[model samples]
Target: MKTTGKVWKYGDDVNTDVIFPGKYTYTIKDRAEMAKVALEDLDPEFTKSAKAGDIIVGGKNWGCGSSREQAVSCLKERGIGAIIAKGFARIYYRNCLNEGLPIIVSSEAVDAIEAGEEVTVDFDAGQIVTKKGTFPFPPYPEFVRGLIEDGGLIPHVKKSLGLS
Candidate 1:
């Protein structure tokens, strides 16, 4: 159960630099420090102003740059509940899922929404409730969603799949 805050909107092709700036790569000794620098290009204050359940709306290629694990760590640390975008880079998407970052791909979600709206995500129902209306996303498998619920791929695999 994640609640939404003022929506933050972004354009298409938001790459890794937007997610994890190059200036912070060398400073990746800590996730809190790395999060302070997240989205340096879009919103330097994002990490500061972000609250739990805040949704990020962006266009295609929402994570098109490097495959740095810190990128996801930053957002998670900032209390970003989920990301809704038109699309995501293959590597970045996988990294997000592996890190238990809930990312949804939907053009309508990006194009038809504005900033500063409360949204409620019901994972079991697979729906997002905004002040405007309820928007449904494509179904996610129980297993995959379970993985995300377990707090990332590694933990999910360890618990669900019983692996080391």
Candidate 2:
């Protein structure tokens, strides 16, 4: 898969609470509603202005804290195409994949990508193309990429079983 989008850069240790505030974890069950409050605590404008296909760039340990699925779902609901970080909290990384949110870990790419810059990510090529230059990261495995392409684990499974 390939996507081109504007960058929404952030820092390290951006927890699940900040991504999708805990206060509404139980209250907001709908995906659309959850997206409306995404990044409310960390980047309020994001909830209002982030466009479809926008990419999030982050420093080390992005998505740290509780194992709230909302954190990943909200962004996916908001139409985030992908997230690139220096590193990711283990569970959050898995959550992203399970939710069909592609994530790339490339400290060099993270350091170079600037907020608001239009960048193109070629998942198949494992390249992030910026005006500055192109950076390469390990591409997802074919099976994993297929999982994302099919829209997460459940959808992929259902399709494999001829249920969808």
Task: Note each model's CA RMSD in angstroms.
Answer: 2.0, 1.2
Q: Write the per-residue lDDT of candidate 2 for residues 125-154, one digit (tens) a residue.
A: 889998788999987888888888898999
Instruction: Provide the lDDT at 89 for model 1.
Output: 90
lDDT tens per residue, model 1, 1-164: 55555688888888887788777778677877876777877776775677666888888988887888888888888878888889999998889888888888877656777777666666667777776677888767777777777888888778766774
Task: Find the candidate with the highest TM-score and give its number.
Answer: 2
lDDT of 2: 0.92
Q: Rate the local accuracy (lDDT) of all candidates.
A: 0.79, 0.92
- TM-score per candidate, chains pooled: 0.88, 0.94
Off by over 4 Å in 2: none
Give lDDT for model 1: 0.79
Q: What are the clashing pairs of model 2? A: none
